[model samples]
Target: MEFKPVTHVLFDMDGLILNTEDLYTVAFQNIVSQYGKDYTFELKLKLMGSQAHETAKIVVSHLDLPVTPEEFIAQTSKEFEKIFPDTEVLPGARCLIEHLSKHNVPIGLATSSSRESYELKVNKRHKELFSLFPYKTMGSSDSEVKRGKPYPDIFLVAASRFPDKPKPEQCLVFEDAVNGVKAARAAGMQVVMVPDPRVDESLRTEATLVLKSLEDFKPELFGLPPYDD
Candidate 1:
């Protein structure tokens, strides 16, 4: 299949470009374990790609936590920060970002992750690579956006950042989770689904293209040569 120009590229940070989801799962398990709530792997499958704050609400509801959503979010953020630095990108992430940056491709990060969590988790070394992207959008952009994943607010915010440029169809989203893909699709952006099969089987039916990993991401898909030799 022929890929388009891909003038703008929006990436989902946590699962797609970064390997932080494992940290989230472990931290969540820690939280639930404290309450004697068994958050099984199967249970975790339901929360992948969800916003951290929203995920906290779901977990609190599932486990019957005696805490408010605000408190749950605060606790989750604290714990997530403790484990986030250990999370880096999956294979080919560095190379792909570097290559895309070299060609002057417009890249933006659209994440449901909070700015504080993102800074603590994705700062420093990541900046060397992500700095070239020149755009950032987070879920905090809208207050009415309550649910994550199924909601398109984050992607819409990211797309709107390019107001002077291409239409929604001109921008493409790279997402690994089913919900992230759903959000991108809802925003009317062309989506390239990078499914983490271990976490997302349902996403296959919703994506424009499915790839095993970013290892298969080619610069030519955006009409550019492979960078870094």
Candidate 2:
């Protein structure tokens, strides 16, 4: 399918840019298994792209765990603190970001992570890479974002922050979550989903394009400069 020319791009931070999904899985399994509950892929999909408290609530309710959302959040937050810093850039993520930046593309981050969590995940070693983004909208912390993914608030907010105030249709989003694909569509933007292999193929239909990895992305397809190779 052909895509409209895009003037700006917005990215999801967690599973798309960094390998935090694996760390999240380990943390979730460790907590849920303590209560004799299993963390299923179906449940993981539902929780993907949700904010911190929302994720905790889903885990507790879906797993029928005997804990308040607050308690679940506290436990998971501790585990995240231990794991998030260890995250590495996902394959081709750096190349794509640098390619876009080198071409003077307007790029921004739109994440469900709180500002604190985002920093913890990136500040130590990936600061230089993230600095390429002119702006970022952290749904958990940005007051202007009234709702998280599956809702269009965060992506819309990110687009509005661009100095050019590009129309939603002129922005392209790269996401790795089902909810994020929905959000981008609701925002009237084109989305390229780089979902995990375990994600069901049927769920990919909503995205303008779905690829196995950012390594498979061709910028020229989106009207952006092609990679030098």
Model 1 TM-score is 0.87
Each candidate's root-mean-square deviation in Å? 2.5, 1.0
Model 2 misplacement above 4 A: none
Q: Determine the backbone clash count of candidate 1.
A: 0
Query: Candidate 2 — worst ten consecutive residues by lDDT sum?
Result: 54-63
TM-score of 2: 0.97
- Candidate 1 regions with alpha-carbon error over 4 angstroms: 141-147, 200-202, 222-229
Q: TM-score, each model? A: 0.87, 0.97
lDDT accuracy of residue 128 in candidate 2: 97
Winner by TM-score: 2
Q: Any idea what lDDT model 1 has?
A: 0.74
